[model samples]
Target: MQETPFCLRVGHLLPYSMLDSNITNFTKTSTFILLGIPGLEAAHVWISIPFCTMYAIAILGNFTILFIVKREPSLHGPMYYFLCMLAITDLVLSTSILPKMLAIFWFNSREIDFSACLTQMYFIHCFSAMESGIFVAMAFDRYVAICDPLRHSITLTNPVVAKIGLAVVLRGIMLILPYPLLARRWPYCRTSIIPHSYCEHIALVKLACTDIRISSYYSLSVAFFVIGLDVVFITMSYTQILRAIFSLPTKDARLKALGTCSSHLCVILAFYIPTLFSSLLHRFGHNVPLHLHILIANMYLLVPPMLNPIIYGMRTKQICNRLLWLVTRKGT
Candidate 1:
């Protein structure tokens, strides 16, 4: 037998990536396959039920809040206007991921184009930041109402609320815009499979071939400053509100004061608690199951959107009466 050439033998022994630097740069595939939940293909039938229910409730509930707020002249105020903004934002967030998630769970259609994935990732981070900002805005609204009731109207006037709304949008957009820009700078590897149901920032960044330390730092700093500072600001706002409430002369006055803030406080907790769990798990709890991470992440988006209307509707008499009147009027 003839001896094999040293050149061919040496090439065969070397890794494909070692042969060419360009070969290690990027994936040939332009689309990514989302692995919805590993080891649960057999149970997707069961998993999609609660998800579909939550999506339906979220959509219907938020739109109802918008409609009632718009129709009832009594509901036209800074609080209701802000609630409408929250509803719209929730709709955007729910729409961004839920449809695709259901398709993945029900139809196994998990492939997303690179551009589309980046777009989805952008909105997910954007709206989540917006929600946190909105929460802080709402807390400020509460503080003014509770602590400075006499000037609340003059302070949060139409022009002022509009400016606050604009600022919220700008804050969310400006901070999160860098994330996708930085993400696209890196080259993806051939295995463009993401291990989650949705196109998330971390999920996309994890697929990059280049060193993403700078990108990760940027994302984390933005998240910490945006979310962490919002939490602290909101807590401080409530502290002031509480001090003012304590100064009120009567028990009923104090309870009524706290009552108005209850619904918003509920929403803040619902939005942040799951978010904290998901963020913590994503960053630190590597040993946690992938399915659990996905579930918590989904809840972070779903639970607040679904529960906000219920919490506020039941807590706020104006909303409850309006909703009931609408239903009974339609029935008649």
Candidate 2:
């Protein structure tokens, strides 16, 4: 007799012969196949070029930000400390997805072990949450610096900043830990083919044969709780900041104060707009093309990390000056 197929072997152990048909396509193995992009498979190699470039820029830019902040003693303030945290989070966020995505696009190496996929999913979302929290902290730092300048030093002391950092990390961990844990409990009896580049939370959950409303509701709740709450905090902080800036007696004073916030505002918009657009597109863009959905999702991860360092490097006087000095010294 011919040997039973690997996927159906488990059915033979059961008492019923009729179960074989139901179990024929069940994924008994822990491997998942990642389709780089559903309909655009032919262009994957070309698509990888820009994706690789953006990932490289993200790595270089964030590292440069960390190095500059670390080396310059004058930058050892609350703002720069939060910036360092942001840089680290951005590095992790992009790194978690890009390499595997590039592997999928360029080499057609699309297999991701189940556990590895969960780990990737955890890192991507966790760091994204941490990045958002860090932005909130940075906004608070600006608010304190501008609105209550007299007590800024006392308010955001080293201990305070360190505690805030710890809270951001813990919040990210506590909140995002459920995604993988809940995902692990689901039975992926369906085919293990994921139709996107990375192991996105919703994408993985959809592969499960069980009812996934819990997972869906939990994911939505976390998004609103983390991103929504953080956005509100940031808005409130900036409102106070704007009020304080406009109340200043001199036009020059207002412009200078607003200048301090320009880079941060740009970074916030860069991060939020793409993220919200992608989330909305994923949920409600039923008529949208699958390739477009995947492309937007990939862009959301790439654009913010690439733009953040560039925005800060251009807008912040100190970082720009330091970069110029470093270049001139290297030239000599």
Question: Which one wins on TM-score?
Answer: 2
Q: What TM-score would every model get versus the actual structure? A: 0.91, 0.92
The reply for model 2, stretches above 4 Å from the true place, is 1-29
Give the alpha carbon lDDT tens digit for every residue of 110-223 in model 1: 888888888999998999999899999999999999888899999999999999999999999999999888888888753466768888887778767679998889988997
lDDT for every model? 0.85, 0.89
| Per-structure clash totals for the candidates | 0, 0
Residues 52-87, candidate 2: write the lDDT tens digits: 899899899999999999999999999999999999
Q: How far is 81's C-alpha from truth in model 1 (Å)?
A: 0.6
Our model 2 lands, by Cα RMSD against the true structure, at 6.2
Off by over 4 Å in 1: 1-29
For residue 112, model 2's alpha carbon misses the true position, in angstroms, by 0.5
94 in model 2: Cα distance from truth in Å?
A: 0.9
Pairs of residues at least 3 apart in sequence or in different chains that clash in candidate 2: none
